[model samples]
Every structure is written in structure tokens, then in C-alpha cells.
Target: MNLFSEIRGLVLDALAQMQSDGALPEGLSFVNVAVEPPRDAAHGDMATNAAMVLAKPAKMKPRDIADVLAGKLATDERITSAEVAGPGFLNLRLAPAVWQGVLAAVLEKDTDYGRSAMGQGQKVNVEYVSANPTGPLHVGHTRGAVFGDALASLLAYSGHDVTREYYINDGGAQVDVLARSAYERYREANGLSPEIAEGLYPGDYLIPIGEALKEKYGDSLIDKPESEWLEELREFSTEAMMDLIRADLKALGVEMDVFFSEKSLYGTGRIEAALKSLTDKGLIYEGVLEPPKGKKPEDWEPREQTLFKSTEHGDDVDRPVKKSDGSWTYFAPDIAYHYDKVTRGFDALIDVFGADHGGYVKRMKAAVSALSDGTVSLDIKLTQLVKLWKNGEPFKMSKRAGNFVTLRDVVDQVGPDVTRFVMLTRKNDAPLDFDFDKVLEQSRENPVFYVQYAHARVMSVLRRAAEAGIAADDATLTEADLGKIDHASELTVAKKLAEWPRLVEIAARTNEPHRVAFYLYELAGDFHALWNKGNDETQLRFIQDGDVATSQSKIALARAVSVVISAGLGILGVTPAQEMR
Candidate 1:
């Protein structure tokens, strides 16, 4: 029941009628036509650009087309007035009954009221928070985790078949370093002063991994050299660290559908297979890369290497797949991973990376393009840094993580709901300042609190109505004579509710879940404004004294607000507050 869509359909029907009456030319494309909310609410409920976009194409003046279109639209019962304004824009004021139907539709649909089929169930793989299994996840990974999880939920809400995935960096040299670090902790647990090397991980989180290693081996490998125990401990320590990471994510309410091991691509033909697929297309070659720009020739040395013709697919230059020493470069495994994703038959791929990885974006896209032959699209979203503040000062780092704040530290302090909601209050590409004091504040300045307070207020209304012996359930609310809701304040809320379905489609199309949070805040503002208005105006109050029918109609609108808030918060993985503490 999208009113904007319905109105757009009416506009299209009118344009077709105009063409049929020979007042307009035949065979004009209406793809550019759009129906959207007017920039100024005081102007109209909705606006359309059909006449403006078609004017030049139809060889007619925009105002002339708008005048004729307005006449056609005025015939519809839903549109109270269609005024041609500003060259060719058509602003429309919908009848009060149209807004009433929006409220009823919200009650009938419940949480699914704004769900959209724009994605059409296309398979999309969202890979995020693929941090190295070295220690607990920090504040940076927290933002990515929250953003990715919310994006996956948003896509699923809009009818995309989404797979939440984590690519483990367990096969790299970093894991070997982790093993040595854990070995030091093992010696410390065995009553020996361990040598804490400069390059070893210094976090106390590995102390348990070391103790676990001691329990498994029982000092047999304690005195052995690196060659004998390195491989065994590497595998064991990575598993332990991954367990810690999983627990951290669980505490933050994130669960991945798949955890891909980077080690799986090793000791197998996967890397070779991925490169061979590219080599078959004449993309692989051995060549000497030109020295990087702005360096003296004497300071730079050229080495022959196995490279992929990434330039053919939009990269700045051809990229090396294998170094002169014959080991695969970092780009090799990345190509193999994306090739694996393409082979899995996903219609699209989305990777959530930290902002530091911005330089890797184009090369990755090039690899996926070459692998899928432009059949699959890859969208990479980079989440910027999060600066934490508390009590007007920078927040202290977590002792457990050694140098950075852990995800659990933030979640434990504010709980998961606040942590997730606050993390997504900004665009992914923009840096976010998360102040602990401000987030916990219960004022309207705090978005999480404001949105939750709105839900809680609606719950309070439902409870009050229930205690007064009024039937306010969905079935009863749906049967209410909604025509009784004619107040301006009440209609303001209904107009906001009508934007939900359209906003859902917009957020999903742009792959931005923060838009949901923003919309919820605006909706809450409208609802709260109307609630405040009832204090002075007796008839504007939701529960009209001694009038059951009118009260039910008003209560119906309040419940509809809660329904949309719950759905929006659900997409953001925030549980709506039943009551504010």
C-alpha cells in the first residue's frame, strides 16, 4: 500500500489517457518520471516531475504539459488537488482518507509493513569484519561488524537473499607470529620467564591460548625448536583466537552465516585454478613493472614477475600475482577468494573494509570483473575510524586488547542495543565520534534514546487504553472509523508513516542502513510533536474521554507508529524499548 507508488500509477494512467486523446504524442518514455515527497511539506503531500522531464522530449512547453497533466490527476478521488508549480513541477495534496488508509495498511501488515521486493531475491554475499585472528576485535572492527550486519538485515528486509560472511586471515604470516606469541605465553604458564619479543603479540588475551597449549602438549614441545612446533601451534592458536573473536561478535549480537578459512586456498589448486581462468583470457604474463613514479632510477630496481593484466579491467596498472621469489603476492589469494565467490553463483558481492583499505578497492573490483567477466557486480564499503569519548575526555584503551578498545568493552559499558544503534548513526565512509556520556543521555539529542522513547511512549498508550477497558488490538484498530482522525497533528503523523515503504526501497537501493536510523528519528520527532500537542488541545488527545470510537481511531495511529519503529529498529538489530527505564 505505497501511496506514492499508487499516485505515480495514477499519473502514468493520466499520461496514457492524454496520449490516447491525441493531446500528447505517442511513444514517449516515462522512465524518467518520478513521484516523491515535496521538498517543503507546507507546499503539498507529494510532487511529480512527469511534465518537466517529458516537456523537451515531447516538443512542448513544461507549463503546458503540467497544466494538462494536472487536470487529468485532479479527476482521481485520492488527490484533492494537483497544482502545477514552478515551471513544470506538479505538487499534490492527497485527501485525508488516503492518509487514513496508510495507517490501516500499517496495522494490517505489522512489522512487514515497509518490507520491499526491490531486491527481487537476488543472491548477495556480504563479507565484513574479516579481521586477522590475532586477538579480540577492536573499535574499528566493531563499526564494520555493526554496519555489515545491519546492511545484511536491510537487504533481507528488501527481499535480497543475503549471506553474512567472514573471511578468516588464518593462512598468513601473521598466524605464525601469533603461534610464537602464544608459545611465549606457554613458557610463562610453565613457570619460566618468557621472552616477550618485540614482534610478538603482547596482549594478555593470548595468555589463555598459551595455557591451553600447555594443557594439550604437556611440556613435550616446550624445549623443542621452532621447526618442530611452529606449524602445530599455528593451527592451534589460530583456532583459539577465532573462538575469542566469535565470542566478541556474539556479545555484540553479530552472527555470521559463513566463516571462510584463508588456509583452505593453500595446499590446494584453488589459487592456480583462479589464475588459470584469467590466464585463459590472456590476462596473465611475466613482465618487469616500471619503477614507482617520482623516484630516482638509481633508487629503484625493476624485477621481472608474474603479473595479471589488471589494466584491462580498470586498474591503474598491471598488478603482480607472483613475486620474483616465486611466492604468491597478497593479491593472488584475494583473486582466488573472489573467484570462489563468483563460482558460488552469487548475483552480487559486497565487501565491508576499513578505510585504510581504500587503495585496494579498485584492484579488487578489477579482479572480480575479470573473474565474472562483468557478470557479477562487487560493491566495497569502507567504514572510517571511530573516536571514543567519555566524560569530556578520550576513552581509555582496553587492557585486555593491550593497545586498543575491544568491542566487548563498548558493548559491556552501554549494552549491545546502544552500541549497535550509535555505531550506525553516521555514514560508513565518514568518521564517527562516539561519546559515551552523550549516548547514555536520555534526551532528544541522543538518537537511540529518542527513537526508543517513541516506541516506549506508544506502549504506554496501549497499556493505558487496555486498563481503561478499550479494545485497541490490531483487529479492533483496523475496524475503527479512521475518518474521525481529521486533526492536523494526527494527519502529520500519517504523512510520515506513508514514507516508510518508499524509504525502505531507497535505503536498500543505496546499500545504506543508516538511512533507516535517520528515518526513525524523524518519525519519532513527528509522533512526539503530536503527543505534546495533545496537552493543550482537548480534542487532539489520543484517548478522547467517553468517546470509544474516536479514541480507537487515534490509538490506531499511535500503534502504527510503533509498528514502523519496531521494523526499523529490527533492521538495525536494536530491540525496541517496551518501557524506558
Candidate 2:
């Protein structure tokens, strides 16, 4: 069904035949031979680097190889022309029936047409939005959540077994802080003036958690000692905050396959086990880390503490896994969590963190690398900041969140579909400016609307065809004579449609889901352009008055556009609009 792949296979077959006949040198590697869309449409349908890549290896000039390869490639039934351009790159033009066949293939396969087997069932663990389970998730966490979820879905579409995970920071002092913050609310629920003290959570969102605590514990525990209540309350409050977080993720349609607890690693000997694996490999030692260059850290003390020789594995400075007081350091639990993943038999681990956590990437990778003895790879993807815009200014802070815009605040304003698509319009490492006005604008300038409009317009055509008493059903459209689609514009769209399978492999190989968003935008644009061209040329119109057969063929093209749009939007976790409102 992939025309580009079919063409590439033909090219490889021709090269192999050349070697067998001694027309070219034997044992020449064709690994670098690629068939992809040329940068300029005027050049050809696809361009290949077979000749250029094999020239030096074969001990021949690029042009000499290109000339010989071109003579052999020109004989393929699908290849109408194979011309060497610019000293070795071969630009290929295919027969019109080739693109027509692609459109028919899309109709046959529907949305699953572009699904690829490139990942080969490798298990990839994606850890994202590991925000502290303290309160409502904010805008920064929103971006990371969307990016990680989309990337997981993209990898799954390309045949990777992806596990979406979140690591809770419940083992730290922050949850203790959350417990104390909720205690004040517990007192307030009993009709006492709650003291919102410094270093305590001041957000109004905790008011409900406090009220819930009173409903559960009432008057009996009101005057209890801190020693008796701290542990119980900490556990209760952390669970409550995680419930709030789960609700937020649900609001955005992000579901995690695992929610790992940092607390579990404590008292379970997991930290010791993780560090022992490193120590057994001579990567752990008791040493004082050299203070970061030219600056005194706030926690800098001359005392020797237990440290991991992280610098030996590529960190800037050796990191401590135990503090001076002999308690496990924050990095200890993280290392254990990752070691746990490695032990789970995952082939790769991808951690999605906020931009502020960029400094931790190197050490985290080093830990996984050393622990797995170079067998497993860890990729830490940092999602940069999302600047919110509304009323032509920044969407100001939320009192409920205490410091930033809660995920609910963003989703409630624009709905989940807009929020998800607009968040992915930028690269993961690049800052994205999301404007409330722009995302909702019903014009081509807005990619969110543009993509949906393309789908909705296709539905409009189907609806009209139905009203005209024409059979636009899949049964009819699937059997329509696509050769009747003869406009240059129609063929251009079919050619773009043929690139879907190729595009999926490219996006998965680079671990970049933004490419999917970008492709959807371009596809939507091309579709919109073709739709507009029908205004001047009635021959290209979706509905040909009084000719049901021709209308069915054009409707087949429109339905195929919907198939691709739905597939692309499914990967993004956004619903494709069937009717624009």
C-alpha cells in the first residue's frame, strides 16, 4: 500500500541484480539508499541517494554509479522516469496510476493504512509529568503531560509497546508539607480560624481536602498530638492529592499505565538494591562531591557523605545517594525507580520532565546506563514552558493553584481537543505560546481549526451526497473508479496521502511527535487548497450535478482525507471534528 516503499524495493532489487550480473561491484551496502519526497515538488515524486551513498564504497564516481543505476531503474513498470540530477541524486517520476493506486489503497485500508512495524515490538517506558502530588497540576505540567501522552501514542502506532508512567514524589518533605497544610483545613472544618502559615500551601483548593478530612475523622482527632497524626495524615493527604491529579489527567484524556511511588522504594530495600547494583560494578563510593564550579551551594558542608561516583558515568560532578545524616538522598529513590524499570525488561526508558529539570537529565541517563551495563538507553525529554495568552495578554495566575494556571483552568476554557493540539504545535524543547483567541479562530491561520475544518468539510460533502440521493457509502466509495479523478490538484493530494507510511517511520525513528502535528497541518492545508480550487474549476468539485458516478469517485477522495485526518488526530489524542460548530 506504501508506494514509496514499493518503489524503494524496486530500486534495491535493481541494485542487487546489477551486482549479480557484475554490472556493479559485489557486496555494496544498500542500507543508506532512501526513497523520500523531494524537497521541491517540481523535482520529482521522490529522490534517492543510492548512487551517492554507494559511490565511495564501490570505488566508483557518483555520476558513474547514478548513470548505471538510472539505466536499470528506468525499466520498472511503476517508474515512468528515473533521471540523475545534481551529480548523483536520482529523482524519480512515477506513473499516474501509481498515485491513483495509493488513493484506492487508502479507501481499502481506512485509517489504519499508515500503521507501521518499524518499532518491532520493543518495550518503551515513558515517564512523564512526575509533578509532586501536592495540588492541582499547573500549566507547566500540562505541556509535559500532553507531550508524553502524545509521544506514547505515536510510538504505539509505530509498533512499540509503550507504557505511560508517572512517578509520585510522595516520599519527600513536600507531602509532609501537604499533610500539614491539610491539617489547618481540618481545623477550619471544625469551625476554627485556620492559620495559613508561611511554607504551607496557601491555595484555596486545599479547603475541600480539609473539609473531606473532617468528614472522615470528625471531632475525635481534633486535639491529637502531632506525633500521632503526622504519619496517618501524611498518607491520607498524599492519596487525596493524587486523586486530584488523576482527575486532572482524566480531564485531558491522559491515562497512565503505572503510577510509581517514591515511598515504596523507601523501607523496601529497593534503594539499597539499586545502589548495590552500582556498587558491585565499582560505581559507588563514600566521597564528598566537588562543589559546583565557582559557587558555594546552600547545602555545602565539609562533611563526607555517601555519594555515587556519577562523574565516572558522565555526570558533571559526583552525586550523593545518601546525605550526611545517613538518610537516602532524593536522587537515591529516582535511581531505584529507574533500576526498577530496567529490571522490568523494558528496552528503553523515556522521561519527560519540565524545562527546569534539564540539569538532572545527564545524571539520570548515567544511572540507567551504568546499571544496565550499556544495554538499556534512557532519553530524558524536557518540555519547555508554555506561555498562556488570553485577552491579548498572559493568562494570569490561578488563586486555586496558588502559583500557576491549573490544567483544569486551561482545559475548561478551550476544551480538551484545542488544548491538546495547540500544546503540540511547538517542538518539545521549544517554548510554545498558546493564545486563547488564536486557537479558536475559525480560519486557516489556526492549525487546530484548520485540521478539524478539513474533516468537517469532508463530512459536509458526504451529507450533501446523501441528500442528493447518491450512494457515498464506503461500499460504493470503495468500489468507485478512482481513475476518473484526473485533476492535477487531485493527484497532488493522493501523492501526499501516499507519504503517510513513510512519515510514520520518520516520526518514530526521531522520537518526535511534533512531526505528526506538523504533517497534519500541511495535510490540512493541501486539502483546503484543493477544496478551494474547486471554486474555479467545477471539474475538481466534490459534487458533480446530475452525475452520481463521478460524484462517488470524488467522494471517495474526500472520505480518504477523513481517514488520514482521523488517524493523525487519534495519535494526538484529539477527536476529529465531524461537524464544525
Quote the positional error of residue 268 for candidate 2 in Å: 0.8
- Give each model's whole-structure lDDT: 0.94, 0.90
lDDT tens digits, residue span 1-581, model 1: 77888899999999999999987899999998999999999889999999999998899999999999999999889989999999989999999999999999999999999898889999999999999999899999999999999999999999999999999998899999999999999998888898988988899999998898889888888789999999998999999989999999999899999999999998799999999999999999999998877775777788999999999999998999999999999999989999999999999999999999999998999999999999999999999999999999999998888899999999989999999999999999999999999999999999999999999999999999999899999999999999998889899999999999999999999999999999999999999999999998888888988999999999999999999999999999999999999
Total colliding residue pairs, candidate 2: 0
Candidate 1 lDDT (Cα, 0 to 1): 0.94
Error in Å for residue 417 of model 2: 0.3
Any idea how many clashes model 1 has? 0
Worst 10 residues of 1 by lDDT: 292-301
Pairs clashing in candidate 2? none
Instruction: Return the top candidate by lDDT.
Output: 1
